[model samples]
Target: MPREVRELAEDPTGVDAGTQDAVLLFVGGPLDGRVEIREARHGEPLPTVTHVHLHGGPKVVHRYDLTPLGPGVGVYHLRPQQVVRDRSVAD
Candidate 1:
């Protein structure tokens, strides 16, 4: 599975402009592992993410830095324009 190939299959660009951008920004970085893409927002810190690097799509070329906001109780929100089924399995 590669970014280029996946991108063709699931074109984030085809999705709503705002949603596509949010998805890319939300999950664009060196992730510990690949997680599924969930549309609905969650209260948990780690919800499934869909972005350029994590998802097998045409986003491998982009570079992003993950900065910890801080160790505090704050509202972290994720607003998605659309939701897609995830195709990941645990080993």
Candidate 2:
């Protein structure tokens, strides 16, 4: 997890400059306490799923879904979504 997210999660008001856009805070799974800055547009909905790909060893992907926390802020929790594996690679 990124340190900035931990800081922001602790104090949302302490968001740094140039990140005035809507904030997406991740909770649970590998992305727990991670933060993502998204451009907020009127009538446009935020992403429902967040994808994290691991390429260090066996290729894998984790998915998380958004759970609204409040206006301009949301917590994306790790869902029961199946982990995607790169079948192209040999075990």
Candidate 3:
């Protein structure tokens, strides 16, 4: 799984910088403490085009993801979100 993430995070040119929602299978890792694979409210994996799981946040300042592209492999990059809200802008 580490190899998969390496490939994904390697070529920034291969992935869009704004796509924060990358799919990754958490086999095991040191950074596992920071990433939770289940939805915060549902406690279930999200059903998306690829990932069986996704990270959630009440407020996310930054994120990086490895969207699966093949068996044990994925396309990786940073994703964007409205981490900070402007009082002037309406939700």
Candidate 4:
């Protein structure tokens, strides 16, 4: 199930196009003891994300950042442009 998300605020281009770019988060699934959250906006996909360092490297990456938010809730993040696009799981 997707929860704990209402809107996303990220701007890397530093351009005010007079449009509010918001994103929804879909956090679920237990993949190697880490929660996965995908980005969605207006029920559409954003960008594609690939977990590069699957091994024991850094905790966060460029496209995605898997970090624990709470005891059972984990916070997943995407960069400004590219992330996990068109990816979702059924509840």
The number of the candidate with the highest TM-score is 2
How many residue pairs of model 4 clash at the backbone?
3
Per-residue lDDT over 39-71 for candidate 4, one digit per residue giving the tens place of the 0 to 100 score: 223322334444444557744444544454432
TM-scores of all candidate predictions against the true structure = 0.17, 0.53, 0.25, 0.22
**lDDT of each prediction vs. the true structure?**
0.35, 0.67, 0.40, 0.41
| Per-residue lDDT of candidate 3, residues 53-85 (tens digit) | 435844323344555554323433444443456
Number of the top-ranking candidate, with lDDT as the measure: 2
RMSD of each: 20.9, 13.5, 15.4, 18.2
**Candidate 4 ranges beyond 4 A from true positions:** 1-62, 82-91
- Model 1 lowest lDDT segment of ten: 17-26
lDDT of 2: 0.67
| Tens-place lDDT digits, model 1, residues 15-90 | 5422321221234234433333324243224433333544666444333333334321112233333444466965
Model 3, position 34, has a per-residue lDDT of: 41
Would you list the clashing residue pairs of candidate 4?
47-85, 48-83, 49-83
Summing lDDT over every window of 10 consecutive residues in candidate 4, give the lowest-scoring window: 36-45
Please report the TM-score between candidate 4 and the true structure: 0.22
Candidate 2, superposed: residue stretches over 4 Å from native = 1-20, 41-45, 81-91
Off by over 4 Å in 3: 1-60, 81-83, 86-91
lDDT at residue 18 of model 3 (Cα atoms): 36
Model 3 Cα shift for residue 42 (angstroms): 20
